[model samples]
Target: MANADARGRLRRPDGGPLRVLVVDDEPTLAELLTMALRYEGWEVRSAGDGLGAVRAARDFRPDAVVLDMMLPDIDGLEVLRRLRGDEPDVPVLFLTAKDSVEDRITGLTAGGDDYVTKPFSLEEVVARLRGLMRRAARSDTRPDSLLVVGDLVMDEDSHEVRRGGDEITLTATEFELLRFLMRNPRRVLSKAQILDRVWNYDFGGQANVVELYVSYLRKKIDAGRSPMIHTLRGAGYVLRPGD
Candidate 1:
């Protein structure tokens, strides 16, 4: 279990500083973020526009990105799309002036891991990045990244899920929900628990979301096969071998 130092600087497996890319159209803000990250002993780079951000993402290969929602050439969402086209699971933190629910939802729905509003404290940004790094580390060190239940197989590293020897593609959210079920095979998980673990409490409490995602999972993982996901009436849901 690796821990950050007093300054909250993260280290890679090779003991080098964690690399971060800051993408913001505002030069001063970008420089501020760069300086703050550098103070934390992280290797930081800045891209003042969306195009440059996309270019740098390919060239810099940053561990995490701090991207502004508003960019010059293209919007931050487009930049994120381009980045995800190459790296589906890249960690991103969006900085946005509009803190509306829709905006937040849009960012998260687009695969942004986290978001920070304008006029944010530098410390808060650093903290969020640190949390992302920790999660990334945990994900990398998974003792068994490949999960199998019956004929369904999920490879965490490659983000691939297969059922009955047929490849199944899933959205990021769907993949996460299915992974959670696979990890707890045969154990009944309530909608509340699923929501908390999968979408986080920040998403508010919507039990229907669990049902919806489960339905989505069923279509992909259970259709035309002995269903592995089971509805236990009042007990919630479970994943186990189907007869």
Candidate 2:
């Protein structure tokens, strides 16, 4: 909720410290998360119910939120839906005991950026939250700039792609997938990882979506250039700067 512009992109004006909201029915867990976030030098607040979570989010306007699935008043998914309705681009990390495939899918489809099952390591959660905040900060800073990889350039703000000065058209999903791949250049990403990171959903029965999107991206990003996005048999996909 914090750093929210008209377009829903997170921004921290005046270079203020990062702020985070922890929403969990368990007061101790909320406090623990709050403490962990604070250890990272972030300002944090906590809430114990859905309505309270919403209110706290509105007032605190955190850069990111760590929400639980089970709540007293409303469900976490509903809370996420409402949050997105108000600020679509707010970064959300679901920290819940709902570890089922369906639950993960529901959380992501509701607009959450990341999901961390309960009983998770505090270090991992903090690292993932930091990654999300970093990405959000980058998005705010370069809202309309072109992301470059070798001779391929993808203009995120303009939704345009060019290779060696030749413009390329891409579908919205293709663009998003490509941007994700480019942003993490050379990092091996499994289909599950790609689905979670790019599609923002669990690949319950939709693992092929990653392959489909990869093909779509290839047609646009590597049609006439060296193959930058490579698929490792039995592994996953990696986007390097060059072949």
Candidate 3:
């Protein structure tokens, strides 16, 4: 698709402009990136450090993030972890130093969706972001937004989760993980599969996130109630109707 057409299609679900967070210590660069994104009819916000980046992300709920790998308070990887903790599905594009191979590798390995080296072209950054946004659009497409298995129910469009006629709250990551489980009821889903299908990126090889997120889901989804999420030893996890 043409850049303009593709950009037009990548907007908020509410039909508003796409929200983008630009995090860079350099003011001039940040301004330039912001201007470019804004020209594309997006709502743009910029942060100058890791702390500000994290804070802005929470407040803005951006559709995508442009994050620098180095920051005054925290590195980009740590910022990514914090961002993913809350907004699991937000795509991130890293800004690494020119020819910094290690920075590029570490950024992607840490779950950044894409990266552009410093001294890069504005067109390149915008283009890469378009690509990431496109991939995200495809990943997010599903047949049914309402998913049910037993007493647990999720309304994907409304972002509501409830069980046993009671409201249940979950972070962005928790919700997506649960949705993936609910979509494939009674089927074993390995950590590898979860990483590939749900997360779509490895956590610097820290695959334990599968177990960690599962535990989080259990606390919210199954505690003090009939268990629906199950772990088969040496196998994987599955979701089914509770007894």
Best by TM-score: 1
lDDT score for residue 30 of model 2: 84
What RMSD does model 2 have?
Answer: 8.2
Models sorted by TM-score, best on top: 1, 2, 3
| Residue-level lDDT tens digits of model 1 in 33-91 | 99999998889989999999889999988888999887879988899999998777667
lDDT for model 3, on a 0 to 1 scale? 0.81
TM-score winner between candidates 1 and 3: 1
Ranking by lDDT: 3, 1, 2
C-alpha positional error of residue 194 in candidate 1 after TM-score superposition, expressed in Å? 7.9
lDDT of 1: 0.80
Candidate with maximal lDDT: 3
Clashes of each: 0, 2, 0
User: How high is the CA lDDT of each candidate model?
Assistant: 0.80, 0.74, 0.81
Q: What is the TM-score of each candidate against the true structure?
A: 0.67, 0.65, 0.58
List model 3 lDDT by residue over 185-219, tens digit each.
99998888886666555334535657767887898
Residue-level lDDT tens digits of model 2 in 141-239: 566677898888988776678888898875434556788888888888889887776655456655755775677678667786788889998889999
Candidate 3 ranges beyond 4 A from true positions: 1-9, 144-243
